[model samples]
Target: MAREVDPKKTRKALRRLKRARKKIEDSEKSDTLSDWEDEFLGSVEDRLETFGSAFNDPEKGHLDEALSGLQTAKLREIERKAAGKARKPMSRGKGFKSSFKRKGSGPRVRDINEDIEEETPEADEIPEAAAEPSRPSGPPKLRVVKGDKGDT
Candidate 1:
């Protein structure tokens, strides 16, 4: 003979299902997604189906055990997947295009002499050539030798 459903247990299960659904909806709102929410929803749905199909009291305990395991694994899987997504941009260099110019683009042309000229003092500001040490205009004169004995 099949066991009959207890009214209290059935009502409690229904309330739990409703709460799980509400939690799932709330978790998915605006900016945050809870990793456990989907798992909880699926677990509740499975438990309700098991209760309906078995029509037995002892089966609820088995459903609870299975639900707990599934929910734990699902939460872990969601965390792993989320972490992988977070790591992708950092690992891939975040779309950095190389700034290096290609070969044959020719060397960069710049007015290097103009830059040097700007830093140099003006010619007029420098002292005239008169301030320079006077250099001998012609070859140096040779000295004549004198004989001590007056020999010609």
Candidate 2:
């Protein structure tokens, strides 16, 4: 026995499924902070809290400016550290040449010009239809391969 599905209910269900899928995709795409970011944010929060505590009711407006300046300085420091770390690898003498050569041995370099040239078909060349057979026209036929009973 088959139960009839209501068109209105089916449409509503599909809309809900689409919304759920969108929500999942959006959540996956949202920005996530790394360990360094978390640390930087924590430091900024601590500094802001301490700075805020030091000020009285008279200096609330000035406190905001000071906090902004502090944040900017901290951010600059973090950026400088990150940049320094990035440069460290390049600063080391072991560059591209050293990477390819055997360690503690004489430089056995290969000339790039000696490599074999590859022939590419010109734009005017049309590939044979036999190269790629057209998909079978009609419903796809499913094949079930029989395996040994012991295989499972």
Record all residue pairs in model 1 with backbone atoms less than 3 Å apart, i.e. clashing.
none
RMSD values for the candidates in order, in angstroms, are 21.3, 28.1
Candidate achieving the largest lDDT: 1
Backbone clashes (count) for model 1: 0
Question: Any idea what lDDT model 1 has?
Answer: 0.50
* Candidate 2 colliding pairs, count: 0
lDDT of 1 at 84: 39
Q: By TM-score, how accurate is candidate 1?
A: 0.26
Alpha-carbon local distance difference test for all models = 0.50, 0.46
Q: Write the per-residue lDDT of candidate 1 for residues 1-152, one digit (tens) a residue.
A: 54445546555555555554554455534333454656555655565566542223453444323233444344444444333333223245534445654578767689778677456466677688635677988999899887688655
Q: How well does each candidate superpose onto the true structure, as a TM-score?
A: 0.26, 0.20
Candidate 1 — worst ten consecutive residues by lDDT sum?
Answer: 81-90
